[model samples]
Target: MIWDLFVLIFYFLVVFYFGFHFAKNTQKEDDFYLAKKEIHWVFLLLSLVATETSSLTFLSIPSLSYKGDFRFLEIAIGYIFGRTIVALFLLPSYFSGNTISVYEYVGNRFGKSPQKTLSFVFTISRLLGDGIRLYVSSLPIAFLMERMGISISPEILGIIALSILSFVTIIYSVFGGFRAIVFTDVLQWIIYIFGGIFALGLIVNQIGTTTLLEQIQHLETLGKWKVFVFDYNQTGDNSYFILFAIIGGAFISIGSHGTDLMLVQRVIATKNLVSGQKILIGSGIVVFFQFLLFLCIGSLLYVFYEGKSIPPDKVFSHFIISEVPSPFLGILVAAILASAMSTLSSTINSLSLTWARDWEMDKWFSPRILSLFFGVLLFFASLIPYFLVETWEKGILEMGLTIFSYTLGPSIAVFFLAKDKQNLPISGFVFSLFFLFSIVITVAIGIGWKLSFTLLVPIGFGCLYGLVSLSRFLKKN
Candidate 1:
């Protein structure tokens, strides 16, 4: 236990070193936000993977496979298709100008009001979505505290964890900026991936190779290896049904990768259009394989536990705490922190950039100041999940994805609207947003429709576009 704690401390020191080291180079807004547009495609690719993976991927994905099968890979399939669309269509426009925020393209295409509105939407969505991610990341910390005999309510423990994670991340982010974020993300990606592989190897070693094969075969018999579900029933919210999963996944990808400033900022920071396109599409493939690795970990975990009735969300964390040995356990815990911090840092930087650049807040205050302010806001925002976990029944992965689904659809819809030659009035955009929100609230909360969360993206896209078009037509008539 002592050795494990030492390892985690050492890891944080190393991350801090990277932050201070990079601080010297981040002297201006461009450096703080875009890394002077000098990052290589390979680095950007790794950063994207790291940033998006978060603690949810590290902790929850395995639980997914442990409880069910590999149907989640269907969404990964849709991710590839969705990213392709973004590469072909969105990348060109993003690269056509020297905009810092992705919303700039919307502003250029439509007007400033729409750009600000989109940025605000992005901010709120990222706050809520990544806030949930922050909470998910806190789970392991809370568990570790309990093991250490730190007696406190789970909520307080979560707050302590959030404070530690948010503080270190904010410091590095304020000083190091985008370059530091990208470089550290690359390092973090390696740590967590290695940790995951190591955990899987440990499980394999414990199970014995021959027995592992038999166990897998037995699992196949139990339908645990089922990857694709072709359910045709559309009367209910079957998210994993092949068509909904694929189409919904694609739209989600479009909204997240193409429209969201957090991921888009990485691609836009690359050298050229081709580099941006390469990294964007390449990330989807990498993510697919990454999910495969974690899902397989979950399956083997099921085998290891001999079908113990473990809560899917707690499966991996439970394994880490109870099953894994000391110092190596610390390494895995550090890996979880790595995943969490990477995303948190990315969120801080991206949110700061959007606020500073889109709203022209940079004119009033320094970039570092804005970064600090948003970091604090995000820290507070992350604590929200403590109040929400009781009412929410799904795992952290699903919750985070659902939060993104709420805003991503309309945000991406605006981009699609931008492609039209006809000017979409600001009033029309406002009305469209209102319309989309009403439908989302009605389906998701008011009536509690069984609509799949995956479909939210497409549904939102259609609502926003349809209303915008109708508004334009009505004005013309």
Candidate 2:
């Protein structure tokens, strides 16, 4: 245990070293935000994979697969199609504009009011959504604390974990800028993937090939390996319905990869249009395989535990702490931290970038100052989930994705409206109203209809587009 803790502490220091090393080169705002537009495609690809995954992918995905089937892969398959569209259509516009914040396009296609509003929306959504992610990432730490006889409430532990992560991430991010983030993300991607691979190998080595095959056969018999859900209901959380998965996944992917600045920021930071497109499309394939790895870990875990009852979130963490050997266990915990920080750091940087660039706040505040400011907000925002865990029944991944879909649905519609060159003949006030309505409908009203959160984007877009078109037609008449 002592050795493991030492390794974990050493890893954090290494991360800080990388961040500080890169800080010297970040001379201006553009360099800070876009990495001087000099990032290679491979680093961008690794960073995208690392940033898009949070503790949710590291911890919760396995739980999801343990309790459910591999139907989530269907959504991953849809991700490939969704990003393909973004690469082909959205990348050209983003690179041509050369703006720091992607929302600038929203301003250009819509109006200045909408641009500022979108920035505000991005800030709030990231604060609330990534806040949940920050908290989820800390769950394993809470487990670690408990085992070490550090008796504390999960809420306090969550705050402590978030603080530690935020502080270390901010130091490098404040200094290193975008270049540091991309490069560190590549390092983190390797660590976490190694952790997953190592854990899987340990599981297989213990179980032996015969036992592994038998377990696989048993899982297949139970239909646990089923990948597609043809249900017409469309209301369930994991509905793998053919059209529902593909269409909803496409819209969500487009919304996230294209409109959400957290992801778009990465692609835009790449060298040029072609490199950006390759990175965007390649990430989808990588995610598909990554999900496969974690889900298989979950399945093998099911075999290891012999189907014993375990809390969904605790499954992966429990194994690492109790089963794995010393130094490797420490390394795996570091990987968990890597997964946590990758998203948190990106969230902090992207939020600062949008506030500084989109709202034209550069005159008032530097990117580093703005990053520190938002980092504080994101830290507080992360504490929210400690209180919410009781009410949230779905796994961490589902809840996070749903919150993202609801909050960002309107923003996605606005992007689509911009793309199609359809003028929204409405005030920012009216747009905000419908935007809130989309969230209300998805969470509150969709309850009765049983609408899955996956469909929220397309539904929200359709509703917004229809209303805006009708108003425009009436004005013409």
Candidate 3:
């Protein structure tokens, strides 16, 4: 037990030291935000993949497959197509000029009003969404502590985990800037993926490959390997119809990668647009295979447990605590932390950069102070999930998506309108405003409308596009 704790602490110390070591290289704002525009596409690609695949995905994806099947992989296919569109179309606009923030395009097209609004929206969405992510990541730690004979409650354990995660991540991110974030993210990407592979190897070794394959084949006979959903009404979170999945997937990709500053920063850091394109598209492929490996692991767990009842999110963590032994167990926990800190560190840095760059703070300590401020905010925000655990019965993945859906549609719509230089009207703004309010209505008022959260992105974009067309028609007449 002491050795396992040492391994975990050693990983944190190494990451912190790297961050401190790289801080000396960042001499100015450009280096801090863009890594001096010298980051290679491979590191950027790995960082991008690692950022999106947060601890939430690491811990929750297996639960998704255990509770469901491979239907979620369809969204991944859409992810590839959507990123291709971003690479071919949206990225050109960003590269056409020196864009420090993705929202700069909005400011140049519409005005400060829309640009600031979208940035605010991005900050809020990231805070809530990643807060939920922080909470989900702590679950495995909580389980581990209990296994080691710790008597703390789950909520306290969660808080302890978040505090430790925030402290370690922020220590490096504050000093190391973009270079540190990218390099650490690459390392984290490897650790977590290796954790998944190690877990699978353990399973295969225990049961023998042939027996595992036989069990997986049996599950396939029971339709557990199913990937596509045809019916519209039947589709819910993690499952989608063909058309809706593609459309939703594309729009969400645009909203996230195309507009969200956290990801856009990575792309803009590359030497050229071509490099950006390669990284963007390559991440899609990597994520597809990554999801498949985790889902297959879930299937193996299902068979190993002989179909015993387990909570959806707890499946993987329970396995780690009850089954995984010694140093490997420590490695798996480190993987989960890596999944978390990569995303959290990137987010904190982005938030600070957006404030410093967009808000025009020239002081050297502006980004650092902002990083500390946001890190603290995120730590407290993470506590919300622990309190809501009983009330929020949906799986962690769905919870994260649901929070994103509230603002993502409007955010995406405004970007599309800005791309065409369309003059957004007051009504258009109202329509965008409704997108945020509708979530409250759905939850609080129980409105008759039953639209799935997955479809919100396309619907938001379609509405804004229609408004833009209508305004142009009236002016022409």
Candidate 4:
């Protein structure tokens, strides 16, 4: 206990120090909002990694990996190609436009409807998305403490973690804002990178080199690590799904990678197009492999505990609590805390910036007022743990991922098509928006549907509607 306390103190101090470090220099909206638009390519790379390698990714991807090797990777492959498209194609428009909120550019390109639609969608999606992200990532810590006889319920555990996270986020975000978030993210990158790598080494050290290979051979024997799921048998995984994913995956990436303020702010902070583009591309390469390391760690955990009655998602936590040696336990705790807090802080700061900038909610409500409302709303949302622990567990895991599809997919489609000189009318935006929501309703009825499928069903109809409407408009004009 003394050791854990000391470790937590060290972790807290490192992050807070950086937050305070930048707060001193922040003096205006741009500084707090866009890091004064002065971050270099290096910081952009770190921020890009920080935005994705959030607490959620750290917790959930390993769970996914422990379940099956390529399921998460399959999604990630499609996602990464989308990132490449954003880096090369869409990122420059930020430079050309010179606005902080990327959605603001949409309003200029298509119309006010698109801008407001995109902004509101981001708000709704992120609240749920980041809320679950906050709740689930910290679950491991709470669970670990319980196993160590700390005596706490998951509900109480959820509050404790959310409180600590909220405090850190509020403090830093109110103090320094964007520069603080970006600058501090680099520090988090170091901690997460080193911590995960250290765990990998320690796991390997416990199992000798020859023995590790033997374990890997065991995995090969069991057929756990294949890269591709190609089914030439015509009934295996289905190629139509693959083709849809490849295309739709890119679209999802545009919404997440290009349109997300968490990332757009980072790229906008860069000095020029070339530097920003390289950082965006380089970050994609780092990101693809970052999760690979987590998946590999999941693979190692399988070998270490060859035949235990346990859950796949719990493997990493189990290793920490029961199997990981002490002393390094302190380092490991610090790493988990870093992953959890950095993600929370960055996200909180992001939501703050997004609302404070995009909504101009400041015109109506004070920052403190908005914070109070958000802090309360999120508290309720985090209790999703109780439900998750109870009857809600299943194969879907789509609630958090799919919420973005309704509004985000259409907004992204409009932006992607409209930006490179494609013409979309005010009414076209209306048609696309209508099509998006109707699909979201049916998708709810058909739970377990993938985001790609849900999004495509609407987008295809929206495109057809757009073309017909455009022809009618041409005739009238």
TM-score of 3: 0.93
lDDT of 4 by residue, 310-374 (tens): 77655776687676655566677667666655655655656666676667776776544564466
The TM-score of candidate 1 is 0.96
Worst 10 residues of 1 by lDDT: 438-447
From the highest lDDT down, the ranking of the candidates is: 1, 2, 3, 4
Residue-by-residue lDDT tens digits, candidate 1, 1-477: 898899989999999998999999988988999999988999999999999999999999998899899999999999999999999997898888888898888878766777888888788889898888888888887888889999899878889989998999999999999999999999999999999999999999989999998998899999999999987775855889998899999999998999999999999999899999999999999999999999999999999887478788888999988888989988999999999999999999999998888899988988899989999999999988878877887777888888788777877778877765777655646754554564465346413664667887887777777777676788878
Candidate 2: lDDT over CA atoms?
Answer: 0.83
Pick by lDDT: which candidate is best?
Answer: 1
lDDT of 4 at 329: 69
Name the lDDT value of residue 252 in candidate 4. 64
Q: Give residue 101's error in model 3 in angstroms.
A: 0.7
**Global lDDT scores for all candidate models:** 0.88, 0.83, 0.80, 0.66
Per-model TM-score on C-alpha atoms? 0.96, 0.95, 0.93, 0.88
* Model 1, residue 200: C-alpha shift (Å): 0.7
Ten residues in sequence with the least summed lDDT for candidate 3: 438-447
lDDT of 2 at 266: 91
**For model 4, the run of ten residues with the poorest summed lDDT:** 231-240
User: Between 2 and 4, whose TM-score is larger?
Assistant: 2
